[model samples]
Target chain A: MLVLTEGLVELNVEAKDAEDAIRKAGQLLVNEGLAEARYIDAMVKGFQDIGPYIVVAPNIAFPHARPEAGVIEKGVSIIRLSEPVKFGHPTNDPITLVCALCGVDSKSHIEMLQALATLLRDEDKLKTIMNPEASKQDVLAII
Target chain B: MKIVTVCGMGFGTSLMLLLEIQSIAKGHGFEVNGEAVDLGSAKGMSCDLMVASSEISSELVDEPVEVISINNLLDRNEIEQKVMPAIQKLSKKG
Candidate 1:
């Protein structure tokens, strides 16, 4: 359970679609050395080919690729957008939080998935995380 | 027991729903095996039941699927009230 601080949040972030947002977020991870730079494009392309399913909860998005898709280590990156981003799902308003993940293996990925499930289930906590005024400590504290 | 959870995306909500299903099924004394795949992939996988959001359920047709459309992924009561009955019905059929 690695917590991303400082480098993850992109204020007033803009993207054309869900895939663009993920690509931008992945690039941030690469810049921080949290993941390989090559993974950014592959991760974005993978989701595009598959569909925009990563826009999970109404305001939350988790963009990821399979374990074999150039992940050197297991990691998680959090990005809080100052404004919401759309993924074309009418029920989903707009994404306020983006959790970009890379798992080393399926077992670890499952554990990570479970933890994420629990976190997103909490509406109050999700609101706290999505707040741009909230610090890294506040985001980590909620999780 | 085999279970499949569906959401708009295979990566997020469906995965989360599967976790809750696994936890509930485990408590109910069932040995469960679950996975989260996109609604499109549901046609290819064989499972005892399929749990999905109400929006996704409308698109599915002509499968032996026992579809449970959850209103909210975080609501355990909704899962119990809506999803559990569908699973039970499927279990009895098998």
Candidate 2:
């Protein structure tokens, strides 16, 4: 299972755009040696190539790259932006939460995503995570 | 039944979709084998249904299976609303 420790969560971050938001989220993973710097670029490129489907829900964007890009470990970095930014999606745009995922392989990949999918589906839990005053412990407790 | 979830890289968004698809399938009392595949590999793969974002599903129009395009992947209600009907249609055809 992918344990989302307090180190992986950042609250009320500031970003210039969607790319900046993703980069900041991925940086948390890189800082913990979970992924390399190139993984961040790969995630940004994924958005450019694949579009804003990564914005999986209203005010939330899940950015990730292929494992081959540069995943040193399996983990996730959660960033709650101070302000929302547009990701160009038809419905789910202006993302406030950016969840950057780094998977070492397929099995663990699905495992991690399953956990997150469940967390994202809960409206109340999502409300807490998106709250600006939410501490890292508060966020980790729910995830 | 088999379902394939398609996305650009396969491991990220598509895998998320596959998990929800499997859960929804189970809730509806359907046993399904789910796989997540990249856009490149999904074309040659065979399955009863294909689930993906609207952008990726548009590219899969030529595939043999029923393609269900969803607006939001994490929203189970949207996925169930869109995918269940297609699954029912597929079962009837089979």
Candidate 3:
């Protein structure tokens, strides 16, 4: 089973900008042995070349790269920014959430993606996770 | 009706959205089928409708296909609100 460990979670992260935010999120996955270090650069370039399209929703940016970019295993990482960063998205700028995804293959990350979508959809649940008062373990249980 | 969920990379957020849309549409009795596609592959593509986060949806704009922008990709209620009407509208056209 793919595990969402506390080790993969970083709350209220301080980032200089979107590039920094993406790298920090990518580093979380890499540190957890879920992805390679170079995967970080891939995600950054993805934004530069592809535009801020990674800002999938308002206040949320789901940064990811191809599986070949450096995915050693399938997993996801959660990084909440202390101050929201801009991805230049027309609507979803100043993102406070960065969810970095690493998949061994296309099919494997589907479950995690579904679960994440469900959790993020619930405003109450998202509030609790982002409340700063909520424990990391609480967010873990929710995820 | 056919719909597609799009993201910069098809396998990530778009795939996430496709599953949620599929689940929501099944219960709505819309008889819809859809898939996840990357923006590059999605261009010049046609479907009854398309769903995506606002930033990506703006790029997805084209004729003969309508794009439904979901401001909050994580919110299921938002998806239902934005998508059901489109599905209802499109299914009627068929």
Query: Could you say which candidate leads in lDDT?
Result: 2
Write down the TM-score for model 2.
Answer: 0.89
Instruction: Kindly report which residue stretches of model 2 are placed more than 4 angstroms away from their true locations once superposed.
Output: B44-46, B62-65
User: CAPRI verdict on model 3?
Assistant: medium
True contacts kept of each: 0.20, 0.53, 0.73
List the candidates ranked by TM-score, beginning with the highest. 3, 2, 1
Candidate 3, B1-94: lDDT as tens digits:
8888888778767877887788888898766788788888888777777787776777765645788888777777889898888888877878
DockQ of predicted model 3: 0.65
lDDT (10s digit) by residue, model 2, range A9-52 = 98989999999999999999999999999999999998888777
Quote the positional error of residue A127 for candidate 2 in Å: 0.8
Alpha-carbon local distance difference test for all models: 0.70, 0.85, 0.82
Off by over 4 Å in 3: none
True contacts kept of 3: 0.73
Write down the TM-score for model 1.
Answer: 0.80
Q: Which one is best on DockQ?
A: 3
Interface RMSD of every predicted model, in angstroms: 3.5, 1.8, 1.8
